[model samples]
Target: MTTIKDVAKKAGVSVATVSRFLNDSGYVSLEAAKAVTSAVEELKYESNPVARSLNTKKSNLVGLILPDITNPFFPELARAVEDVGLTYGYTVVLCNSDEDPEKEKNYIETLKKKYIAGFIVTSNQLDAPHYANAKVPIVALDRTINEKIPIVSSNNAGAIMGTNALLERGCRNILFLRGPEKLNPANDRYEGFLEAIRNSDAHYQVVTCPFHFADSQKIVENVLKDHPQIDGIFASSDVSAAGALKAAGIVGKHVPDELQIVGFDGVAMGEMLSPGLTTVAQDVYKMGAIAARVLIKRIENKEIEQNFYEVPVKLVIRGTTREGME
Candidate 1:
């Protein structure tokens, strides 16, 4: 559909002028108003003020740049964002940054050139040097490099929620697994797990994984060989958690009986497992919804000068946790 933006560009007048003319406001000059009217007529413009605002500065569109859209976590979050966006009469543009800094930089530059209203960035690493010159408002999801940009993240207080969930369930010597350490989320969760163990007067071992299935499996296999006393395990992510589950099965260990396991992200795979995986649900869907609302409010609302959107975390007790334990 030919929008008011087309009319403004064709008439060579500012979008505000076209909007004023369309509204029959008295301020627009007679000549400019006539040109806008003629252009609107010729182009069959729909006179949508929202589309006209595209030319002015607000396009009623919010772009979401996620690190891994393929991940179950991201897809659910994306759906939540799109759901909330449509309700507010705004459009969403989805982009995958692939966790590459250069790819992320390119996406920001591309969206800016396309005149997107704002962005909700979900990168793996927290490095956004490109934002120092960003023209539009930006909200970070999971990654926050610059203090100037608003961050909407899960409450990364600690893995105590996940770790303690496993420990209290008779998991004496547990294996705590991890992924890449570039971002603060992983580090924070790891630290929380350690604190939980210390506080509980329990003994556990930490195993570092490379944020992938195969690598984590290798780490688990090595840990199993070195330590046969491990009674429980806490994997950093659902992907790696799945790998841990499979690896334990390889050694003929029954979940929550011979051993207990817990995962993160509350991913779709968690429930499908034999013993549904207990996980620390970060409320990914809510995170995306909150991020969209905050960035849009900060940009559209003239009243609010500053804001912070913080998402809370919760431990989802599923079939994965010990049947009778904590």
Candidate 2:
């Protein structure tokens, strides 16, 4: 039960030092090596051959393929996954697809050749047939790719809650900034937003974006040019919401007054915005941890019944929207 991290802590040495002592993979000072050996003996630490064998037959690495590293959300998710993988003595290889399908496919092929233990993919494309025949386990993060692969994501209820928040703030006219239709989470958010406003008196419109700030900014600017009556906006992601904010500012519309906005993805940078973006925050860390745990279990050939896991979300109220705007 005692891990190398535990040995490292007790020995007052780094985990890398302990790992080197354990595997003789690299050079270590005699004092550090002695400390690690003493600590391992004291703790009765046992190496997990079974766990090592899971990835060792090919490689002791887990591949984490993401759409964009520039997106803060994905990086945070990747960090959590890497942390989990390291705790289990596996190296995490990060591959950014940059939202390119061909690039994603190429990375998949490359990592496959490397014999990665498993994959935690945040796919940009809707259909990824390359992973269909992946010999190792695969888990989708934040979106559904292959139907056979399990997916771990945040709850789509944030959209409904966000829409209601805007409506509660006296926003009668709202705009929903949706993301790519191929993403399951994006579609869920769009559907949830529509469902919330269906029976309400709030007038709403939908604008799809590529989930990029520039594109979303342009879309909002054009939408505002034509429909100045738009008082509220609910964006599918924080970056898009930032674009909406920029457009509102360009038109001299004050947040929480003339125009209120709510964005999905409770990214850390949201708090840095001028008014601190109001958002529906997903537990990115939790999503990553759950995905890593599930994928590792699958890699170990453990029996798992549930294939879909949805982490809960919260409505993070900030200065962007009013509880009941006057």
Candidate 3:
């Protein structure tokens, strides 16, 4: 295999100059750059990534840590991150923590040992101190880790919008299908829901469930069975909204007439549901893309204008809600 020294000899440049040019670490004269490029092309030279990482203390790999892969929303987010990473000449390594703090910690330590360049994290272990001291650039996606860490997320007020939609449709008794209590996004959404109904006369109940479909379905089924007065449901996620919809059907509740539902995250599966799902549509792809870009920029020592990036969200009306209520 051709080596950097051979490239330097072929281009009439010192090995140090060639290294500087290849890594873009230091300035090289235009003539030297041109010669190095020509030599590299002629020799078909491919630098060893492992050696380069050892020398630079960083790799061409970005780590994306997600809380749960079973949620459909995360897959879409992962795709966006992967696409952006590839475009920027970086490979994305996906790590699913399954909402386990120990697993997430292990992934972080292992990736850091391998000199991973940066991280895009959507896991629930943001409160861990190691993340604050990870010494690696981290961009929180769809979750708030802390003020010190940069975050890219949609407006949490989307939940308020969803809640108001249910209230406006004459839903006096509403049930909120919330996610885990400790998760930041889940708390932000639950807070948004409370803010929306603060002065309203709606009687609402909050129930916690995992983002999984089966668990949400089972919980929602029980809630619907015990409280026949629940005329509307505002789920923290589209998967939960789907569960509520299924539960309503199993309990013989006619949707949009007897019960109305609103879900967050405008995932594609929402549209496949029988009446379709009305949702607070967040641009999951854009959030992921922005997180990746922010991480890459930090890795490249570029200036970022802001630490907190808030993407906008909108309420999408669909078959789940009553017509003429928008």
Scored by lDDT, model 1 comes in at 0.78
lDDT of each: 0.78, 0.86, 0.91
lDDT of 1 at 153: 75
Ranking of all candidate structures by their TM-score, best first: 3, 1, 2
List, residue by residue over 25-67, the lDDT tens digit for candidate 3: 9999999999999999999999999999998989999999987
For residues 86-164, what per-residue lDDT tens digits would candidate 1 score against the true structure? 8887789988888888887888888776677888887766555676567788888776658777887777664788988
Give per-residue lDDT, candidate 1, residue 143.
Answer: 69
On the 0 to 100 scale, the lDDT of residue 237 in model 1 is 87
- What is candidate 2's lDDT per residue for 1-326, written digit by digit as tens? 89878999999999888866776667999999889889989999987765545434556688888877888888888889989988887788989887787887888788777677899988856666777776679998877766778999889867899999998888999999989887788999998998999969889999888778888988999999899899999999999999999998887888878999999999998999999999999999999998998888888778777999989999999989876544
Worst 10 residues of 1 by lDDT: 301-310
Number of the predicted model whose lDDT against the real structure is largest:
3
Q: How close is candidate 2 to the true structure, as a TM-score?
A: 0.81
lDDT of 2: 0.86
Residue pairs that clash (backbone atoms under 3 angstroms), model 2: none
| Model 3 spans with C-alpha error above 4 angstroms | none
